[model samples]
Target: MAKRFQIFLIVCLSISTVTFMLLWQGQKNNKDDIRALAQASAADACIQFTEYQTNGCESSYWYGVAAFRSFQQAYHSLTEGTNKAANYTFCNEVYGCLVLSPEISQSNISEIIETMSILSSDVEDENGYIRMSELRNSLTR
Candidate 1:
């Protein structure tokens, strides 16, 4: 009976240790995945916005809306846990543009293109990843 109990305890501890290690690694990988998703989403937004510019809003209204929605989602995810005035301002501005008529929206194509250009650069830069890592570290601490 004593020998069986010892074996059981050893197996339980080994299993628990392995489980803990896997969970830790999975969490790290998840963070990396989300970061990549944010980057990719931003890039897609830029591409779609450029397409909207090329095709014009009269014909590509839906494309512009879709791109704007994607940009909003990606921006929100990337900026989570950080409070910055510029973030809110940019989001609100884009939201306003999204709600306008197609003719009005066409007039704002330049603004949308510029915004996407800036966002693309930001997401492509290491600073975006660093910011997310710092935020994660601060929370863990």
Candidate 2:
């Protein structure tokens, strides 16, 4: 009976240790991913700015769309385990910066890109889809 008790205790301890280690590693990985994402966001901003300057409005719009798509895909992938709020916030920050840039004034190109960025970053499930839809309708005007 004494030997059986010892074995049970040891097994419990081992399982507990392994569980803690896994949890710690998971947290560390999440932190690293967030850091990498922030760096990527900044880098994308700089590149998009340059591309817009050299490639013109149409090219710049495409770049914005591509970047948004990339973020959307990433958010969906991580939704199972990651914080959806943080993901949306990150997307919104990058989107707003790109869209609100002075280089994309209404006199030349559509300013709806800025609004779309704002909508995409919404945490309360209020992505500016309605506004974006309206803007699209006005594009032919």
TM-score of each: 0.57, 0.39
lDDT of 1 at 34: 51
Whole-model lDDT values for every prediction: 0.58, 0.50
TM-score, model 1 to reference: 0.57
Which residue pairs in candidate 2 collide? 119-128
Q: Please name the candidate that would achieve the greatest TM-score relative to the true structure.
A: 1
Q: Over all chains combined, what TM-score does candidate 2 have?
A: 0.39
For model 2, residues 96-123, the per-residue Cα lDDT tens digits are: 5345653433332334544444433441
What are the root-mean-square deviations of the candidates from the true structure over C-alphas?
A: 8.9, 8.2
Q: Which regions of candidate 1 are displaced past 4 Å?
A: 2-30, 57-59, 84-89, 100-102, 124-141
Candidate 2: which stretches are off by over 4 Å?
2-22, 25-30, 68-141
Superposed Cα deviation of residue 43, candidate 1 (Å): 2.8
